[model samples]
Target: MVHTKLKYTPYFSISSFTFIMIRLMLLVCVLVSFAAAIPWLSPAYWLSPRAWPCPEDAAIAPCTCYADDDLNLFMDCQNLDSFQQLVDIFQVDFPFKKFGRLQISNSDLRDTLTAAVFPDGFMFREVIMFSNNFLDVDPDTFLPSKTELTFMEFSDPTPNFPLPAELTQLPELREAVLSVNCSEIPAWASDSLVTLTIRCLQDTEFPSPLNLSHLSALHLHHTNLLGVPVNSFVGSPGLQTLSLNNDQLASFDDGALSFTALHQLDISSNALTTMPQLTCGCEIQWLLGEDDATMPLIGIQNVTLVCDDGSGKFDDIRNVLDQLC
Candidate 1:
């Protein structure tokens, strides 16, 4: 009986169909833009031409971003003269994703890395502050408050090393290459650090070997060391490799270096008149052979020693080791 006036409703209307299509296109566009903001994941990644690759928001102010084939993003702000300039960039065109590395050079002395500037939370795996005129960071405002950075390097153009006044402990920092004018290791330097490379202008010995027992590799470059003090390396039993290179060191104190189990020692390019005594049980790795008198070292079986009488006495040092050791 109801079929007498049965009429079929239009299953789909033109307006409704158009609306659904528009919504789907909008969703696709959102996804595409989101991927594009992540640099390497973007569909246009291969289309853009750059060294290694390109990065998200390359147009951001006072900085240039680059992406590698490994999907690592590097932010270069060498052109920016101050931290305030960087802050001004993020205040306007911040990236959607955190950067993998940040490089800032030729910047001002007042530039500091902290939450007040990068309020969105500065997350970086590596950082480089190179060729800077000065690095005048305030106490405790040098690093991000929330994020944990791993590696940091610096190159100061100024005469001083530009060491921070109050170097608050950075817990997540593992490796650091700092250029400072410190006569001794700073108290604020993190003890949890693994690799410590200090480029200083001091002729005195490093702060204290006891303070850096946790270090595995210790490199002191351009430190202007007159000599490593006696027992300077007494407490660094954990140090596997020690390098005192590119300095003004005239000599290492007698018994100045006594590592429990050192694997390698590099005392190259220094003005050393004699070699320090190696304690018993200390391992050695000879970088130069005994006959290589030009370098003033002996190529021992397991250890490396630098005994330059400058009179072809390298053989004498080797003979001594061969007899006693």
Candidate 2:
């Protein structure tokens, strides 16, 4: 009889174990990707704002609400034929009252926009109204969203266009763009406001001084402003960019540019015979015009500058000003 001895063999070596783990990890990654690619397969989809049901189409006929990429909901209404249609749209019961944005454009809707246009307790972060003829915008129209509204824009050529007085009550408001025929910028009282743009449809004036504490950028175009009044921007200590383009500015009032943080002053397409005095110690860029063109492309153009002091278009603004700092 011969004794037979058998050698023990392990089910898996160290390398084999590592390989199995790698394969398992790859399978998990693939499964996760598949789940993410298919909205119905992911838990996030169930938790997203998209999961929230929107109102029926018939209920909000002219307007539509959908979730944005950031998961916030946007309500867009375009080509509204009449203000009654707007009234009918808001009269519907919305399952979701909190919206990220509200846009209304290219419509015959006119006259006053009262609080009735927006349902009570409804909140919006942004509001845009363009190409409409709203002669009177009631101050309480945006009262419900005073705390949540961050951005607002309104456009149209309405003489004596009334800016909403409730704008000053909005604590979270940041940017406002008004393209109307107003005489002056109101004394905006928002501490959170950062940018303001007024595209005057007619000649405008700065009858009052700006008193914003946190404003950084301001653009005034087609205002036909004759000159910057004294203390025009005295309260905006943090203002950095000031653009007064397509106006009739011939000179700046004494100490108009006294702010310390002004970095860019664009006075192009104006009637300036001489450079506006620069008081800021920081280096400033004075935009003169678009090179080889009568007008500048919106947000895209080659800016050209000519030093009035005979420095010959120097890159350093100090050279143009002949001030050594």
Candidate 3:
């Protein structure tokens, strides 16, 4: 058997391998150079912090790209004339798990904030809009399916205020502060409202049949109220705090003190000459009243009376109540 001797050329094999490696290196360099010339070709080059178009002394870092959830916390479209801008900004589906508070205050929002502006599952817990005229919005403009909203503060500039009935759909609402130009309470309120603070109720009657069974705090400060009827708070079983200070209340009917669960009551700095016999039975802890009567409160602690006589001598009201308790 004649076996042929195989030619072993190590130099030739090494030369071929080196040539292939050199060609691969040259190809990689050309690709990289081409990517560097284009603005949107390389992600690393696009994301470089030095390439951002922001001012040198800016407090925030320059950002050309944003996550889907970053824009939900704050949206200020003050005097934005185009409706498309409003729709584009609010149309993004913001992740609810990341956002907790949203503020759209002092914005000249036009008719672009309809119900379709926000996603259906938006869950904002707090929303504040001071001096935004949303009265022209449809009643169902903010009809969200599920909202974790706890508070809403809206200050309107127009006198003919229109409260939407869709507010009652929010099951978790706790506080609503409305500073409107109207002189009376909006008739379109729901029973789910617990804390209401109205600052501009002038020449308006305390709307009769106010459902306050679940209300805990009520503030009517600086609202021109002539007189609250006796039966205004008749059904508020869970009322704890009542503030009617700095109003034109000449007198309170006996029904004002009918809340059994009341704990703190403030009726100071009003035009009152006599105190209403609050029938809350010893549950009241703080009674801030005006000292215009001859006899002080017989039983109450932490009493602060604002009197014209300047004597602060009604300190003995708590001592009398302590003996009875």
Candidate 4:
């Protein structure tokens, strides 16, 4: 039982050991918190405006009711400048509450929104997605329950998303702006839309046989509409403004827009050698028929019947028509 050499193991009291364990745990917690603050590591948190970084000089003022003025939230990501940056800033599946108006002007968020990025269950009054360079938007732009919106706008210049006809189910929907080369006018658009602005991206003619009986404004800009076709503005009794400006309209049909009631017609900057007569009742305030002299119409209060050939001095439509003749 005699030991030649004895090595002793260090031991601590209960309180001392507990203190050491607590310090180790605190160190792990600090590391975890630092890791979560990394934007790339925690994409969902940084994408949120609530968790976004602010300047050190911000002084940490905190108070908010409205997002900005009448708008509940305004996400101005246009400065992001790239698709990847937009994705880094806005993570998918971020939960959110209902907002009055949410205006997202992103130049880089051109991704096809097939899945829910933001919590779409929050019913919104208006949602504006605009100015993206190119976006191939999917059919379910917003959630089904969110479809009961008042106004929805997708004003990307080269958007390939077809107008989701499901928007017609929105009982309160009024206006929509889209940029897509549609082969045919969205069928259900006649249900609740009062104003529509479509900038066709392809070299195609405007879809025919439109029946927007309640539409007040129809803007078909920058397309290959080879003239206002017969029955094109049919059944739109309340149609007030018809804008087919800056397009490939070669000629207007005599039966074009005969059934509708137009108050302001804009056929500016088109290739037109002839101006077909119209029967739309009401004195149009702005009859903008560029590159043409013969102003043929039912009634026009203020008309700009001038040529794009750098000669516009006549203040009267009659004088301009006389010069062309």
Candidate 5:
């Protein structure tokens, strides 16, 4: 039997196996590199552009994109036109956790946003919607179950025809600034509002059961108010600052404000002939009244009388207000 010696070239076999292992390792490295480059490889990787894509477009010029983690501070989203665009950029799906800040000011948006657009427990801290021409706003549009919003601003140049009742449901809101028509104030506002500023209120009479017990400041500037009940500020235990400057107010119901926490009061440049005897006590610091020499200093620290004195000293009402501030 001739035993054919098969060529047992162990060296070549070992070299071949080593080459295959090296190739496999190199292939894995290349795959990982490609996977890492995918995010930067395409400009389309980011969401599409709408009315306002970048923060810069939203009047927050020189906008900076925040990471998912930095949500403790306030988020400014002023002047962003398209609400849908914001939802895409934030990657906010239903049942969202928490969002930092959102600003949608001076936009043409007229509809209310739904909870489905936000994450669960939609924790939105600050929201500003100023100068939007929204005729109507649904209260439920901002209500996120179990979420607590701190600050909200809705200052529109256009009149808000009527606001929904759902706004009263947001008990977690702390500070709010609403400069719209008097008709928009929901009946429940006095109950839930803590700090409120209502400018240009056209109504002649105040709402019943004024539940501003927790209100700190009340701004009713540039309104057509003729008279306010003396007990208007009765239940407002935390009332600190009150401004009724530049109004057509003729009289304030005697003892109209019994605010215990009353600190600053401004009723300057009004049609008021006699200043309401404010029993605001020594807590009153600043007093602004019409420019009349008969202006009595009722324990008020600084008083700016806006009278029709021929000296033109009282003509600068706005400058006086600024200096007081």
Candidate 6:
């Protein structure tokens, strides 16, 4: 075995060690910069606020955005003097495109409410308009929110007004209340419409041939309807409640109450001399029990109801003639 003297060599020199450390530090710096570029990886991003809850007040002046604790947003633009002001206000950029509810009441926004009145991407779940005089609305005014809108109301006697025929296009619309001056229910087919209330401000008869298949409740108030025509409710075969309160109705066609779903029929405060003939199916429970004289109906206790199923379906019309509580 030959033993040789081993030469002593250091693992690394000082310069070499320093160079390796520098390379390691550079790699760490690169990794740190990459992490900072990603918002989810940065700790500061999580601590910072994401966005402002509502729009700035000055940007939407006269119209206010209200944010609830549950984060629902509502916009109220009521009593605006000019229609131009409304158009100008919507021209500003809104932080949110969706609102829970929109209200415009007692505003002098005359002429036509076109699609330009709303922001480009604006949508509302509920829209209420009241006391807007001489204002005509475009058919496509609410087309953008056709899927989002659920409730709509146009009350308080708008003259020369027509119910927006475009409302039939909304698939999600559920309830609607309208005050008609000269409007009539256009040919519409809605599957989601459940309740409808129409207040006739002028002397008008009932609108026939309604196409609301999903309509469960129908209320006609303050109308000059003399009688209900035959097959008046043929389109709304699913209607369960029918109210003709506060109308000048004297006669009702037997075909009007021929649907099978109608259980509650209210003709209180009307001028009916005799009980209207019924041809519906289901147990009929007359709300009148021989003592209620406030209603104009005569011999209601003795009138016979014809049932399609021979179950003796009854009509439960409330005796409270003036008040539908």
For every model shown, the clashing-pair count is 4, 0, 1, 0, 10, 4
Candidate 4 residue-wise lDDT at 74: 33
Compared with the true structure, the alpha-carbon lDDT of candidate 2 equals: 0.70
Q: What TM-score would candidate 6 get against the native?
A: 0.70
lDDT of candidate 6 over 15-63, digit per residue (tens):
9889999999998788778877754555554465543345567777788
The positional error of residue 201 in candidate 3, measured at the CA in angstroms, is: 4.7
lDDT of 1: 0.60
TM-score of 4: 0.58
Per-residue lDDT tens digits of candidate 1, residues 1-325?
Answer: 5558778899876788899999999998988888866665675665666433433455555578777777777778866666567777666544434667878787663644444665655567777877656544433443553155677787663333333434334666677798754566553344566787887655545554445546788887677766666666655567777777778877666567666556567777876665655443313323323455533234322233345454644566655655655
Give the clashing residue pairs of candidate 3, or none.
Answer: 183-202
TM-score of each: 0.63, 0.69, 0.59, 0.58, 0.58, 0.70
Report the lDDT tens digits of candidate 2 across residue range 99-186.
Answer: 9999988888877787888878778899898887666676567878888989988887665433455356788889988787666666
lDDT tens readout by residue for model 5, 207-297: 5446666788777777666667656666676777787777777766656645555656777777666655533232222232344342223
Tens-digit lDDT track for model 3 on 1-325?
9999998867545578899999999988887788877544666655776322221112211112122343433333344444455556555433232335545555455442456766555545666666555544444544452356677776765554324654567667778887766676654345567887887845656765466557888888787777787667655667777877788887767655555556666666778776565532343323422232423233423333333134545445445545664
Q: lDDT values of the candidates? A: 0.60, 0.70, 0.56, 0.56, 0.55, 0.68
Residue 172 lDDT in model 2? 88
Native-to-model Cα distance after best TM-score fit, residue 44 in candidate 2, in Å: 22
Model 2 spans > 4 angstroms off: 1-52, 159-163, 275-325
Q: Which residue pairs clash within candidate 4?
A: none
- Give model 5's TM-score versus the native structure: 0.58
lDDT of model 2, residue 223: 70
lDDT of 4 by residue, 1-325 (tens): 8878877866954688899999999987876687676544464555655633321112211212235544354333334466555444434333344556656564565566543544335456777777655557666656553445777777665445534555555667788777664544454545677998777666665556666667898888776566566776666667877777788887766656454245567777787667654322222222323323533342332323323233543245434444553
Runs with alpha carbons beyond 4 Å of true place in candidate 6? 1-51, 159-167, 276-302, 305-325
lDDT of 1 at 138: 38
Candidate 4 local accuracy as lDDT?
A: 0.56
